[model samples]
Target: MRKILVLSVSAGAGHVRAAQALVAAATGLHDVEVVHCDVLDFVPAAFRKLYAELYLDLVGRHPHLWAYLYDKADRAPREAWFSRMRRAVERLNTRALHEEVARQGADAIVCTHFLPAELLARRIAHGEAVPPVWVQVTDYDVHRLWVQPGMRGYLVAGDETAFRLRELLPDTPRIAVTGIPVLPPFAQRHDRAACAAELGIDPQRTTVLVMTGGAGIGSGAAMVERLLAIDGDFQIVALAGRNEALLAAYHRLAAAQPQRLWPLGFTTTVERVMACADIAVTKPGGLSISECLAVGLPMVLIAPIPGQEERNASHLLEQGAALLALDATALEYRIRRLLADPALRAGLRQRCLAIRRPAAARQALDQVLDADAAR
Candidate 1:
């Protein structure tokens, strides 16, 4: 069997989730032994903790600062002096990661996060005869950090991202536009009535699903409160993803509007929740938007963090798949407008379906395997 190493880092949940989607796609393939792991596992404990926490801290509490830093990093040349220094420090901290990659003895390596790809690129550049490395960018935008030399190929979420990659890497390694892969549940449509019945929500009333992403860009309670003012027969299903205080806040809101407020925290059944909702209000992370597209769920994107998410919002708005909700008032206005027009909602859903790539993980794997065969 051809062993394939699938590596990811838990900087945020999206990269790890994307890697899991790839693993799910490769599960039953008899010819391939797929090994999925975190590259950070090979690094020292302190280095791993600090590296992961720094990202969450910046994006969660200090968003504008995070945005500024993100823009600064992306604007610099891919292999600029400071970038080289940063990568050098990373390499020194993750010395064992290089050895782990070599020890895996895999035919090909796939990275959902950029760090492993950069580390492996160094080995390939040094003529170490490392396994070919394919990178799956988990976002709509390509930052300078992800543009590493000596990559065999890349899979991206959109055409513009591929174009950006071409501009950065003049060599133009084979770039595939395989949309961000989502979980299996998102690929199939659930019965709306059945899902609604299970959740004890009204099937006939318009339902809006709200997700405060892991980054916590927006306040769930505030969005729900703003939605309450809209003149419509609607129930809001607000999900506070892994945030305890927010979940508690939702419970308090639910007390007064028992039939109207559906509060959920850290659910695994997002597809089912989506099935019951007529419209989705969310932060447009790459994976989240991909999942919405897979299910033909129309979206109103809110509180997109400045750099990558703003890029994601622009793409979705231009595609006619989502609306941008800039503030509480805009969110209420958009939701009211979308709820009032069936034709408009249908149009958005159709656009989402048109752009959907539910089997992106499978498509990406096939392409990678084909490349390996040619070699």
Candidate 2:
């Protein structure tokens, strides 16, 4: 059996999710033993906790500033600074990872997030002799920083993103457009009405799935309160991902509005929810947007982060597939507007269908195979 190492970070849910999907897809193929590792999990507990808290705080309290930092980080020339930082953490992670790699004798290394890809590439550059490192771009817009010089493969979300990366870094020969690497669950067909009935939702009323990203970054409490205040009768499902406090708070707030409000905490069935939803109210995280498209859920985009998400929102809007809303008030109004006009909804739905890429994961797996075959 060939071994494959899937490296990911817990900075946000999307990166971890993308890695999980790739592992799932890769495992079904013969003779592959997939090992999953959380990059931060290897670090000191205090530093790990501090990193997670700081990441959430920065993105939640200052999205624009975080976006600016991402852009700035991408623009800065690759230096020994991050390489040295990785080396510092290497003392914590290197022994365990090296043992696992040597024990499994890994044939390939897959990275869904830049942190691990960066670290692995630096290790290889330092003559660590690790296996082939494949960097999978998890977002719609490709960042220049993801293009590590000696990477064995680069799997991007789409041809446009792949082309863009090629333009930015002309020397990376392993680049391939493999879509976004969504799992088969999102690709599978479910009986939408049946799924709705199972979830205790009214099939007649339009179901809107509202998400606050992985850590519940936004004021979901305020958003749900404002939505309830609108006096609408539509079925609303609010997903507070891994936010037990937010979920409990919503449960209390929803006490008076059980018929229209449905709150869920961390769940593995988001693809099913998206499949059953008529529309989705969400931040424009590329993974979420791509999953929505896969499930044919038109999006009412709200509170996207400033740089790449802003670009993603604009792309959806320009494609006539999503309705953009600035905040809670706008979100409520846009939801009503989208639900009210059948013609508009149909138009947007068709556009979403046009953009849906169901074969992304399989295609990405093929690219991994091709790269391996080439070697």
Candidate 3:
């Protein structure tokens, strides 16, 4: 059996979720032992906590600053001072990671986030006999942080992203345009009426599913309030992931509204909820967008994080699968408009259908394993 180590970080839920999806896919293949590790776990506990807290603060409280930093980094060269500093900091955790990989005898290393990719690339550069390294880009845009010359394989969200990556790494080989891997549930078909009945939602009413990614870090409560104010015969299902306060608030709101509002905490049944909904109001994280598209759900994107999420929003808008709402008023307007017009909803659904790749995880797994075989 071949041991495969999948490295991810929990700075945001997307990277970890992507790693989980890949693990699920890999488990079904023969002769593969998948080991999952969070790179942050190797760092000091204080640093890990601070890293997560800082990410949340930047995205939730100071998005504009995050955007500025993102743009600055994007424009900077790979060997820039900031890049070097970031890599130097990352090196602190490398010894622990190297020990873990050596202990597992990992024959292949897959990275869903850039930090591990960089560390592994550095290992290969230093003449270490590191196994084949496969880096999966977890966002619609490829930042300079993810580019490394010696990576064995690159898995991207789509051809447009692939084109951009090729431009960034002209001589890099094995770039595959695989969509971001989502859980198998997202790919499977669900009965809308059955799901609605199961969730106790009115089958006849138009359903709007709202998500703000796994951290639940956006203006979810405010968005829900705006959505409720919109004049339409619709039901709202708000998923507040890991945000206990937000979940409690929504639960209280749901109590007052009864059947009209359905509040959920972090759930494994998001696919079922998506099946029951006609539209989704969400933040455009790559995994969320990919799952929504897999289910052919049109989207009203609100307040995506400055860098990758912004790029994801642009791509979905360009594909005609989603509409961006800059504020509460715009979100209300977009929701109302889509609910009132079946033609518009159908058009957006068709666009989503055009781009959906339900088997992305499986596809990515096959390619990664095949690359290992060839090596």
Global lDDT scores for all candidate models: 0.87, 0.77, 0.85
Writing each residue's lDDT as its tens digit, candidate 2 over 128-224 gives 8788988888887877667776788788876778788777774666788777777789988888788787677887787778887422334787787
Output candidate 3 Cα RMSD.
1.9
Alpha-carbon runs more than 4 Å astray in model 2: 80-99, 213-218, 231-233
Give the range where candidate 3 is weakest over 10 consecutive residues by summed lDDT: 213-222
Best by lDDT: 1
Error of 2 at 261 (Å): 1.5
Any runs in candidate 1 off by more than 4 Å, and if so which?
213-218
Query: Over the stretch 270-358, how does candidate 1's per-residue lDDT look in tens digits?
Result: 99999998899888888899999999999999888788889999999999999998777778888889989999999999999999999
Candidate 1: worst-modelled 10 consecutive residues by lDDT: 213-222
| Model 3 TM-score, all chains together | 0.95
Clash pairs for candidate 2:
157-179
Those runs of model 3 whose alpha carbons end farther than 4 Å from true positions after fitting are: 213-219
Q: Per-candidate TM vs. native?
A: 0.95, 0.90, 0.95
